[model samples]
Target: MSKPNIIQLSEFDITQKIIESLSNVCTRAVLFSVKNESKDATQIAEELKISLSTVYKTLSNLEDLALAEVDKFIISPEGKKIKQYRSRIGKVEITVDNLEPSLNLYPNTDNPKSSL
Candidate 1:
């Protein structure tokens, strides 16, 4: 699959946000779970066996960091609508030296393995 986009950021605040997202296990799990496909909160919670509330909270946090994004809305046969989230990024590389930080974000590609 072709690469989505490659972005390199040096802004401290943005870099810090990315770092914070990856530092937490729960957030990381949520991020990884939606890497290749979009899934709703319920699906994510079920797959990870995490509480629904926790999944929502985690998704919100990831969204704040631009790590997870709402891909689309799906309508069930019962006429219920659900928001699905996909991983906005595939991989991240952060470097810090002498208090200087830089972040590289790799957007998710069609072939998950291609990003690595």
Candidate 2:
């Protein structure tokens, strides 16, 4: 895998949002679960042992933050469309200097071993 790009953010509002999301246990779990492979909500929910509704909600939040994206869609046996989500972020680093916080976002790579 190629070296991933790092996105540094020092803006207070955006940085705060990212910090909050990363601080949440559920959000971190969901993001980590999809780091290597795309997975549907049901799969993520089962893997994390969280409720389906919570998975859906977390996916929405991730999308809003541009941390997760819909990699593809699948047609279930019942002819229902299911979204397969992947994490856009492979790793995150936070720094606090002079009472200011900043974030370093590492983009996810195609190689599973390269992902966090």
Candidate 3:
């Protein structure tokens, strides 16, 4: 039998990736709430407690990660669908089981018996 290989992420990007994962879930919820409506970048901004531009950036990041998608079109202030930016499903799977919390399942740091 062959042993398994492990790949680790850089300490810097690990945190960023975690933050991105959290942001991903949040964006999904926001999209689901406004599934049938056209939500502007400002709306997402407010909902996410971030700047309008932050919302745009976050959405762009989410889209790039394939965690969400947007449909851009013209819209009117009079409740008209002039140009709507519709959000849709573009989920990214995250397999957590194989990652953190299992790195050192059976440590031999103090295995006195093995010293025999």
Best by TM-score, which number?
A: 2
Off by over 4 Å in 2: 1-13, 111-116
Ranking of predictions according to TM-score: 2, 1, 3
Number of clashing pairs, model 1?
Answer: 0
Per-residue CA lDDT of model 3 for 40-92, tens digit only, reads 67676676676766666656654443333445555666766532344343222
TM-score of each: 0.78, 0.84, 0.43
Candidate 2 clashing pairs, residues 3+ apart or interchain: none
* Between candidates 2 and 3, the TM-score winner: 2
Which residue ranges in model 3 land beyond 4 Å of their true spot?
Answer: 1-19, 23-36, 76-83, 90-95, 100-116
The superposed Cα distance between candidate 3 and the true structure at residue 94, in angstroms, equals 4.2
User: Could you say which candidate leads in lDDT?
Assistant: 2
Off by over 4 Å in 1: 1-12, 111-116
Note each model's CA RMSD in angstroms.
5.3, 5.4, 16.3
Error of 3 at 23 (Å): 5.1
Model 2 lDDT tens row, 1-116: 43222232333256788789889999999998998999999999999999999999999988777788788899999999999998888888989999898787787885343322
Q: Ten consecutive residues with minimal summed lDDT in candidate 1?
A: 3-12
